[model samples]
Target: MDVFEHIQSAKGPSLFLLPEWQNRCHLLTAGFTGRSGGVSESPYTSLNMGLHVGDMDETVIKNRQLVSDALDWPFEAWTCAEQVHGNRVQRVTEEERGSGRETLANVIKGCDAIITNVPNVLLVSYYADCVPLYFYDPVHHAIALAHAGWKGTVQQIAQETILAMAEAYGSRPQELVAAIGPSIGICCYEVDGPVIGQVTLLLEKLGCSDDSADTMLELSDNGRANLNLKEINRQIMIKAGILPIHIELTQWCTGCRRDLFYSHRMEGGSTGRMASWIGIRER
Candidate 1:
């Protein structure tokens, strides 16, 4: 069964929810947004969660508010980072809550991963086709949102987030539940040149066998390879000590489902973004 359940409500933002996680902890909410039920115009055409995109700032903020309304989360708690496709993980605290909600100023800087144990602080990251990595430590009541493109994946952002959580919140990797959200799958993610070289080096560093590497990167005759970033990140999570069974990998490919998602590759680089969010409320 798919870990993220798609839900479209008549009066709210479209969302892909992590129902099992929500059910396991009534105070927790975790999910990704879809490209519908917002107020942005064409290209963005409704729900565009990214303020940095060409979408009007007001429209993007309204769309974000719609999501906050749907999630029943306070808009003041929507914290985000300016993702730089790097492995740096920022630890969000109570004072940093609500940064980057309405504007880019005061946003957490140059980090792909943001984690927080502070209750009611929602950590969000934007994506069109890049992978969204989620980490939750129920024992510590902490959660994280990481944006990983192929660059961040090669930098081992997953492992970096795990280590940051351990150092900041005393979260054990084995005890943490993680999720790899929707992104371009191998079916539609083809790459050549340095991307292929970097992925090959990463796989080797992960000690993946030839068969494992083959599964992650299928080389074509034209010097391009189809890359499965979700799988690669899953393996990285396992290597970083997260239990394989505890990690949920979604099969929804943004490239394949452009009707429901924004595909940067398929959409010719002019597209809006979806958001992946995770938070816990104080009881």
Candidate 2:
């Protein structure tokens, strides 16, 4: 079964929702945004959620409003960070709610992952082809969002986010329900040089068997390789103590579904970004 369900209306933004998590907890809303039904122009086309991507501030804000409206969430609760593709995890509190919603003035800086137990704060991270990792510590009412590119992945951002949650909210890894959101898949993501080297080191550190390592990273004779980031992150999650059964991995690849998602790799570097958001409303 596809863990993320695609929902679209003729007059609304296209969204991929995590229905299982929402049904498991009515107050929770978790999903990824798509590239249609908004107001940005050309390359961006419409529904560009990233302000840092050269889209007009007003246009991106309007697009964001459309998403929040569709989700029935107040735009005021939309909190985000300035992602540096590092493994730093910021602990969001009520005080940080709404940071970087409209402008970059107060965006949580220097962090690629944000975790919080603060209800009503919608934690969001932007992505085009890079992976979006979600962590829900149901037992502690804490949630986290991480942006993992090859750099962050090799740095073990998933494990870092899990440890951050445990330290901040006493979240047990076994009780953490996680989701790996849409991004480029191995079929569409090819890398070489330092990327392959870094990933090779990471697989070695993860203690992957030869067959498993080859599956996560298929090396070609030409010194290039196809990387399965989603699977690598899932293995990192399990290595960090999260149970395999509790994680939901999505099959949606932004690189392959250009009509539904904006792919930086496929789009010649100028593209919009989608958002991965997870929030729990106040009870």
Candidate 3:
């Protein structure tokens, strides 16, 4: 069964929600946005949530505001970071709430992962084929969002986020719930020599056997390989102590389902980005 449930309402943002999480924790709202329901021109189409993607800042802000309204979350609480595809995790607090809600200038700097125990601070990160990693530690009342491209995945950003939550909020990795959101899957994410080399090194370090590594990276005769980023990140989560049963993996491949998502690789790089958001509301 698909973990990310698509809620297609005439009145709300086109969102793929983690319904299990919402049902488990009523105050929590966690999900990824689709490519509709807002105002933006061609290429960006409608509903582009990223401020850094060269879309009119005002237009992007309006789109974000629309989604916020749909989520019943205040646009003021929508906090974000400037993703650099690195492993750095920033711990968001009350003082830093709403850091990049309106503009990129105030966004948390140089981090791909943002974690917070602060209520009502909605953590968001943009995506256009890159994976969105969601983490929640109900025991600590904490949550996190990590932007994992192949670079961040190679750098083990998933592990970094886990460790950061453990250190900052005393979250036990075994007790944390995780979800791997929509992204370019192996069916469309083909990589060449340089990327293959980096992935090979990481797989070796993970002690993945040749057969298991082949499942993650299927090489072709032309020296390109289809990379399973979602699975790699899932394995990384397991390696970091998250139980297999606690992790949710989505089947929506952005590349395969461009009608429902934005694919930078498929659409030639000049495209808008969807958002992955997680927040714990204040009661």
Which candidate leads the pack in lDDT? Answer: 2
Question: Residue 58 CA error for candidate 3 (Å)?
Answer: 1.1
Model 1 scores worst on lDDT over the 10 consecutive residues at 5-14
Q: Each candidate's root-mean-square deviation in Å?
A: 0.7, 0.6, 0.8
lDDT of 3 by residue, 122-148 (tens): 999999999999999999999999999
lDDT of each: 0.94, 0.96, 0.95
Taking the tens digit of each residue's C-alpha lDDT, what string does model 2 give over 136-191? 98788999999999999999999999999999999999999999999999999999
Q: Once model 3 is optimally superposed onto the true structure by TM-score, how far is the C-alpha of residue 187 displaced, in angstroms?
A: 0.1
Minimal lDDT window, size 10, model 2: 133-142
Once fitted onto the true fold, the runs of candidate 2 whose alpha carbons sit more than 4 angstroms away are none
Question: How much is 272 displaced in model 2, in angstroms?
Answer: 0.4
lDDT of 2: 0.96
Q: Residues 1-283, candidate 1: write the lDDT tens digits.
A: 6899999989788899999999989999999999999999998988999988888999999999999999898999999999988999999999999999999998988999999999999999999999999999989898998999999999999999999999999999999999999999999999998999999999999999999999999999999999999999999999999999999999999999998999999999999999999999998
Per-prediction TM-score to the true structure, in the order listed: 0.99, 0.99, 0.99
Task: Quote the RMSD, in angstroms, for model 2.
Answer: 0.6
